[model samples]
Target: MFNLIRKDVIALKYYFLFIAAYAVMFGLFTVSSFSPLMICMLPAIMMTLFASNLELRNKSMLFIGSLPVRRKQIVLAKYGSVFVYLALGIILAAAIRAINEYGLGVEFPLTSLNLSLSAALAMAFAALYYPIQFWLGVRNSSFISFLVIFLAAALIGGIGNMADSLTFDMLPTRAQLVIGLPIAGLLLLYVSYRISLNLFLRKDIEG
Candidate 1:
């Protein structure tokens, strides 16, 4: 599992470049808002690149599938890697927030209800995005098609003020959401793993 996470982080080198760029922009803007938004992209980027195609291309899945490891292990390892990334992002963001507030005199909260909510948003994204990656194994047209659809929907929503119209405030408060998101994420991940296991067992690891 550790090795799998190591491989995942290694594959994320390029993704970190985007993260670095986001960091610079946040500093320029002197706002933590964008910072959390950027970190929330972790799952999307990871799924699109590493989780989706990686296991298949690298044959890690095949190798693991051949071993005594259960499908749950594979799913759990992927979730574990994302959690590590999320933790790292949170820590780094907090550090930067501290520096910006203390050193730069930028007003950013060390801990905020907003940040808490954003973190939950990150989990939701992670929870929803990964199973497609796990099951499709990257090169499958289904994943690509869904990716396109999701992007298009987002773009169209952006153009149409759908975000503004949405009643987002009705959801749980930040504190509650923070606790709820991971529980929801874990449930979704388990469901996804079960689906993936059924599919994998019914299909071909080498196919």
Candidate 2:
């Protein structure tokens, strides 16, 4: 499993440079709290797609399956890579926010809320994205994923001001939402993972 994960990391070695560039670009340019989170997650999403493609392009699916690894392990490692990338994105977002706040003496408003919102959204995205990719194959599903990401970004960018203007009384309390959103997102991701595993197992058995 670790080697599977490592294979993805190695395959995407050059892409990390682009991911870093994206982090810096969005971190510096995006003013809205939630929007920054969206920006930070973009690379992670793209990286997950790229990693999955790496396997598909080389027929690593059959190769890995022919090895000692289980089909379930392969599915788990694929989904697990998404989580790992998300964690890295969150860390990068936090670091960028901290630098903006303390090092640059600029304020990053709603830092915690932004992190939570971004994470929940990312998880929701993965929950939707993986099943499509797994079922349709990445080649067929990539456009749909791109479209979803674009729509999400448009919503966040367009509605950020309205979201910022809303009073605390109009929405759930920060404490509640911060915990609730991530939990919901996690549940969705878990469900997606299970579905993907079942799909993979079914296909493997048939093959």
Candidate 3:
């Protein structure tokens, strides 16, 4: 299982580098907002599906599918890789936030919101996405993923705007939403994994 996860990391090495470049570019020259944190998160949300697309193209899935591994393990490994990228994004965001706050001596906006928002975004995307990818395969999943992300971004942005108009006392405590969203997101991800695991197993049997 660990090796399967490692294989994905190895295969996506260059893509990860590209994400680093993206982080640096967005980090250095950004409006101080949740946008930077959200942008940094896009890579994590995109990579698992991207890696699966690459595997499908290269016929690596055929090789991987032929292995002694279980279908559930394959799904789990893919889900695990999402966190690996999430961690990468968090580290990049933290470093960028540090540079913006300390090194530049500029007060960065949303510093308090960065980590939790990143986690919430990543987990939200993962929870919503993985089942679709597993059920539809990469090609079919791509469009829906894009559509969902777009809609979600709009909804979240609207909610943020609304929240901004309220006094701090009226807002859900940042502590509450930040913590609750990720917990809920993780539960959703687990449910998604179960659904995907079942789908993968059926596919494996049919194949």
- On lDDT, the candidate that comes out on top is 3
TM-score of each: 0.68, 0.81, 0.84
lDDT of 2 at 184: 86
Q: What order do you get sorting by lDDT, best first?
A: 3, 2, 1
lDDT of 3 at 193: 86
Tens-place lDDT per residue, model 2, 85-147, is 877787777777787888887666636666677777777777777776667655564576676
Q: State residue 202's C-alpha deviation in candidate 1, in Å.
A: 2.6
Worst 10 residues of 1 by lDDT: 40-49
Clashing pairs in 2: none
Better of 1 and 2 by TM-score: 2
Q: Which sequence of candidate numbers ranks them by TM-score, best first?
A: 3, 2, 1
TM match of model 1 to true structure: 0.68
> How far out, in Å, is residue 175 in model 1?
3.7
| Pairs of colliding residues, candidate 1 | 52-138
